[model samples]
Structures are given as structure tokens and as C-alpha cells.
Target chain A: MELICPAGTPAAYREAVEAGADAVYCGFRNDTNARNFPGLNFTTEEMGTAIAHGRARGVQTFVALNTFMRAGEEEVWYRAADDAVALGADALILADMALMDYVATTYPDQRLHVSVQASAANADAVNFLVDTFAAKRLVLPRVLTVAEIAALARQVDCELEVFAFGGLCVMAEGRCSLSSYITGQSPNMNGVCSPASHVRYREEGHDMVSELGGFTINRFGADEPAGYPTLCKGRFLIAEEDAYAFEDPVSLDVMDHLEALRAAGVSALKIEGRQRGKAYVAEVVSRLRKALSAPPAERPAQLAQLRRLSEGQRTTSGAYEKKWR
Target chain B: MQLPRPLAASINCLPLPLVQRAVALVFRQVLARHPGLFDRLGPYANRRFRFDPTDLGFSFVVYPAGPDITVYRAGKAPPASATVSGPLVTLLALLEGQIDGDAVFFSRSLSVSGDMEAMLALRNGLDDCGFDLPRDLSGLAGPFAPPLQRLAEAIRARALAGMV
Candidate 1:
């Protein structure tokens, strides 16, 4: 399977390529894609340069113009698509149906990969996108079990890709309203979730309270590890108990099931976190590459090295194991 | 008042101006090597970032847009948009972008306050530059570069291991 990595900057793009990525995916500096943070992402000029750099090294570059286009701001998404195609991006990971139609009708031959934001998990949805937009690949949302993925793979004609490691999203992809409910901003619509502008942390007595907007997300004791202030991972007073009602604060790590994923007809394994830095990009890419090439006997030890790197120093297989259900 | 840690008490004994001069020299060397380091932070560069070495009892207020770094004796630094406090080794490893920052932060080895976005931007900016303090400082020793880097690396390793 191809090892697709994430990069938020030109420097990280270079690091990903150097660290042995098959393809590095990123986004433009604005809200054309998700992860529209303060000092992350590349300008058109930087994108062009970065793509050229990756191309020379035999590493493909995928531009993620994955955000849904606003009603009247169709021009913004169109211009981003045009620039990405013009800059020779190996593929465009798109989510908006109208934008996909525009790219398909305008550049009939450009390879398209349906972004996870499209939420195309089933065969019909996946096949429909492939038949309609000539989509070459479909990044399955992080809601599928191994058996379900294998089942879906057999039914769809397009290539299948799955997220290997990164932050876990408890809500449905491209349909998250938890952030909007708490912070008044939709991740899919506004390209930011738990926006730092709306996040605050304060010490209260013996605990550190992390808040989103004005609502308390979670509180950690003086000696406890802190998690990000996102709504899905927040602790709530549910059923007369103080508990993590939605999901625990842990990152998704599915490296141990590489064989199952490959056998399930997966073409690529994508790492999430474009908001992360080059340090993370380089370190994870190199480690994943090493694990991919290591012998079966040594695979467990190699994969286990990544545990300390996970969020809250904990990793979960998420929906893949079907344990949560 | 006694310092909280041995590292802090030892560093607190040094003359403030001498320590300030030493830190400035290292900062100058890094900026010279990576000219576009802070430029990557964009508007976040204009904000003051304070690096507090909890073990060392000293802090650094870096105004990246001004292209200036000033050392302060612990809590004496000017107001900052963000402050990241940690052991001296943890802070240095973070600057070099060699360690997994989120892992360290999540493990509670580091603590951040003030503006989250600005701090995140600065962390990304530092990661892009790949600042290696030992190797960068080794450049100042002329013919003694190799030995200096080795010694610095040894000291850093021991410090992180709490051996020194």
C-alpha cells in the first residue's frame, strides 16, 4: 500500500518527501480546505514550489480543496482547483459535489480522490462518485470495521484508502455539529474545529479546566495529563456520573492491522494532522516506513515504538475493532 | 529563597548580564543560520513568546518580528502572548524539532499558557527551522567544533536523564 502523509507547510512537504512518503497531501493557506489555522498551509507560490520539489523526488503531491464551497463563494473553490491542476498536483482530494463536477467537466483526465469529508463509506456512494466524477480513489471515513471495509472494497470499483494514524473523530465525517453546538463554528463549513480563538484554559483550585467557547470541555487534576478542548472528547455529567460521554481523548492508531487493511484492497494509508508540524511529519513518516519494511516478527516491536507518540500517550483502534459498539 | 530544583539554584547563581549575553550569542547564531525561521510564523511572529526553563530558573522573551531575544531571570520577563514552561532539556529538544511535541505536552512534561494559536504557530515555526542548539553553538568554537558538539550532546543527554 502507498504511504500517504500530511504536510501543513513547504518545509514539512520537503521533510515528508525526504522521510520516504509515497505522496504528501496538503492544502492552500485559506479555508479552501480544512485545518485553516493561523500559521499553517501554503500559498499558491509555495504550493507550486513544494509540488515541484516533491515531483522531482518521485513523491506525488495531493492538494486537498476539501471544504464545501459556500453558496455564493463558488469562485474561491474553483480558483483553488484551477491553480492546483495548473501546478501539476498528482491528484486533487475533493469533497464538494459541485466542485467535483466542475473539475470533472473542465479537466476530464485529472485524477480525483474523494476526500473523507465526502463521507463515501458504502459501495453505492463510492461507486456513484467514481462513475460520475471518474474518481480514482475513495478515502473511507474512520467509521468502518475491518470486515465492513473488506466487504465495501469488494463492492466498489475504485481504489480504497483508510486512515492509519491520527486524531480520532467521534462524530461522522463532514457532518460534525459538536463544534458548532459549542463554539458556533462548524468544522466542515468553517474549516476549523475547537478554534483556538474560542478555546480557553484556566486553573481552578487543584484542577486545570479546558473550555471551548464558555462551556467546560474537561477538567484535569494537578497531576493529570491534559487533552485538547474539543467537544467530542469532553467529559460530561451523564446519568449522574462524571464521565467521557462521547469518546475518550485518544488518537487513532491502526498500524497493527496493516495486513488486514492490505487484504481489504486498500491502495493507500493516509496519516492525518496537517495542523501538525514538520517534526511530527518527519518522525512519523520515517517510523511508518521502517515498520512497513520490517519483517513480520519485528513488526510488533516496531509499531509499538509509536505508542509514546500518540495523544494522551494512548492509542485506540477506534471503530476498526468494533469493540465500542 | 531557595530555588525549586538543583538546576534552578545553580543557574540562579550566575551573574544575570553574563547569562543574558550568552543566550543572545546563541540566538544570534541560530537566526543567522536560519534566516526565514520566524518568517514562517507570519503575523504570529509579532507576538512575544516566553520560553520558561523551569529547571533553570530563567526565561527567554523572543519578539520574533523584532528579530530580538532577551533573557530574563525567571519570572522577570516582560508580558508575553504565550509562555511554554518545561525542563531545560525538554525545551531544547522542542526547539530542535527532534522530539514529538504533542507527546511531550500531552504527557505533561510541558505546560503552555496565554495564546494557544500564537504558541502553536511558534512551535510550527521552530519545527520548520530544525534548530539544533548543540551543533549551532559548536560553530562558535572554530577548530574545537567537534569536541564541543560531543560535550554538549553528552551534557544534554545527562541532563534529560537527570544524571547531572
Candidate 2:
């Protein structure tokens, strides 16, 4: 299977290519992409350099214009599409329908991939994207079981890609508004989820309390590892039991199931960490490359080496195994 | 009352190459485990990094040379083009990918000065190397890795406890 990697910056793009990524995806240094963090992403000039760098190394470079375009500021996202195509991105991964319509209409021959943020869960949703926008590939959301993926793969005309590893969001892609309710910056609209600007960490007696928009999302014991204060991954009081009401701070790593995913008609395996550093991209892509190349019997050993690198040093198969649901 | 800082200052008086060789031994083991890192950092092979750990109240320099990086504890300011300063744990956390480097840097917990490109390259290189000190050290140690890992954790916990 092709190993697609996330690159938040030009430097990380180079690192991903060197680490054996078949393709690397990034975004403009604006709200036009999902991971719009400060000191991250590439400028238009940097995008040109990155694509050139990737092409020289025989690695595909994709630009994510995946966030929803604001109603009045539609031109901002449209301009981003024009620039991405002009800069020679191998493909454009997009979620917004209006923007997809715009790109499909304006740049008819440009290769387009349905962003996971589009939440194209079922075969019909996948088909609609391909038919309406000529989307060459569907980056499926992390909500399907292996059986379901195979079923959808059998029905869809376009190639399918799945997030093989990275942070797992509990909410459905493109539909989550939890961060907006608290911080007024939704992933779909602003291209940020649980933006760092709104997050705050404090020490309360013996606990380290992580707050987002002044609401206590989680309180960790001094000994427990504290994660970023993302709303959906927080612990809360439900039924008088303090538990991870949404989801735990763990990463999704499914390297052991490459055979099953490939059999299910997965065209590419995408690692999901645009906010991560080059070290993360290099290690994840390199390990996945090793895992994919090894004999089926020897794959587990390679996967074991990745556990230490996971979030909170924990890894889960997530919805791929169906236990998360 | 102020003897610890003076004591640490005295320790910093050790020969730079001596401390560098000791650090280089451990870091070489880390790089040896991940060969892809050398390719990621091939562009900036000769860059120098000066790390100022305010919590530890000492400074050190690292020189990346091909497959291995040499570390130096400096008695005086390091002759590095780029210098990074942060709390000891924060610096360690950044290396381990425990926290986002940009987030910590923006929050003013970590600071970098001098050559921006070189600093950025080194940061990316370190990230690509994916060094988890305890985990990598344990892996290098083979059968005795677990005990060594526990000892490293103890040191980490004690060090972080004071900051909290």
C-alpha cells in the first residue's frame, strides 16, 4: 500500500520524503487548511519549493484546502485552490462542497481527493463526491470497521485511503462543532480544533487542570501524563464517575493490519499528524514502510517499536477493530 | 543557601570535549537505532546547538557530525550560531515529542535565538530522529532496558515534580 504522510511545514515535507513516504500532504499558512497553528505550514513560495523538492525525490505532494469556506470570505479559499494548482501540487484534498464545486468547475483536470473532513462514510457519500467533483480518491474518515471499509470499497468507483495512524477524534469528521461551542473556532470553518490560543493549563492543589475556554476539560494527577486540552478527548463527570467522557488521550496505530486494509482495497495508508514535528513524520513513515515491506509474520515486531512514540505512550486500533465504538 | 548553583557552575567547569564524548556515546546509540534520521538531517550536517536549561541552571552545546552528535557542557557561553533555552523538562519533552515544540516555543516556555533556519532544521532533525531517551536507551541496553527505563523515569519524575 502507498504510504501517504502529513507535512505541516516545508522542512517536515522533506523529512517525510526522506523517511520513505510515497506522498506527503500539507496546507497553506492560513485558515485554508485544518492544522492552522502558528509557526506551522508553508507560504505560497514555500509550497512551490516543497512541491519541487518532493518531485525531485519522486514523492507526490498534496495540498489540503480542506476547511469549510466562510460564507463571505469564499474568495480566500478559492484563491488558495488556484495557487495550489499553479504551484503544481500532485493533488488537492478538499472537504468544502462549494470549494469542491469551484475547483471542479474551474480546474476540470486537476486531480482531487475527497478530504476525510468531508466524512464520506458510506458508499453513496463516496460516489457522490466522485460523480459530482470527479474526485479521484476518497480519504475515508476514521469511523469505519474493516468489514465496512471492504464493503464500501467494493461499491465505490474511486480509490480509497484511510488514516492508518495518528490522533483519533471521537466526533464525526467535518460535523463536529464542540470546539466552536467553546472557542468559536471550529475545525470545519477555522481549520483548527481545540486551538492552542484558547487552551490553558493550571495547577490546582494536587491536580494539573487543563482548561479550554475557561471550562475544565480534564484534571490529571501529578503522576499522570497530561495531554493537550482538546474538548472531545477530555475527562468529565458523567454518572458521578470521573472518566474520559469523550475519548482517551491515545493514538491510532494500525500497522499490524496493513494486509487486511490492503485486501479491503485501500489504495494508500495515511499517517495523520500535520501538527507533529518532522521527527514524528520520519519515524512513523519509516516504521510503516518497514511494516508494509516485511513478511506478514514479521510485521508485529516492527509495530511494537512504535508504541513508545504514540500519544501518552498508548496505542489503539480505534474503529478499525470496532472496539472503540 | 546558594551552593547548588555554584556547585553546578563548578561542574560546568569540566572539559568540554570530556562531557561531549559522554553525551555523544548515548546520542550515537540513539542515531544508530534510526538510520532514516541521518537522511532527514543530511542538509544541516555541521550545525551547532547550544542548549540552556534554566531549571538545571546550566548550558550545553551539541554538534551534529554525520551519523553522531557530540554534546558539550560549556563553562562559558557556547560558540553556537543557534541557542535554545527552556526548562530542563520542557527541553527533554520537546526532544521526546511529548509536547508540541511550536506550542511550547509560542507559550514562552522554550526560546530559540540566532540562525532561524539552522534552528528550525535542527528542531526538524531531532523530531525526525524521534528520540525517546529512556525508551531508546533501554532498547540499546537490551535485557537490562526495563530497569534502566525505570531509573530514567524516576529521575524525570523527580525533576518535573519540582517544576510543578
- Number of the top candidate by TM-score? 1
Full-model lDDT, candidate 1: 0.85
For candidate 2, give the lDDT. Answer: 0.78
Q: List residue ranges in candidate 1 displaced over 4 A.
A: A204-206, B1-8, B154-164
lDDT of 2 at A316: 86
Residues A1-325 of candidate 1 have per-residue lDDT tens digits of 9999999888788889999999999999888898887777888999999999998999999999998899999999999999999999999999999999999999998999999999988988999999999999999899999999999999999899899988888678898888888777776877888887787776787577888888888988876766667888899998899999888888888888888998989999999878776777887898888888887678778767566667666789899987857
- What DockQ results do all the predictions give, each relative to the true complex? 0.44, 0.09
Candidate 2 lDDT, A1-325, residue by residue in tens: 8899999866678889998999999999789999876556777998999999999999999899999988899999999999999999999999998999999999998999999999989988988989999999999888888889999999999999998888887679999999999999988999888875576655566566777888989877745655556888888888999898767877898777888898999999999989777656777788888888999888878777565556555688888888745
What TM-score does prediction 1 earn? Answer: 0.93
Put down candidate 2 lDDT per residue, B36-73, tens digits, no spaces: 55443444557777888774545766666644454544
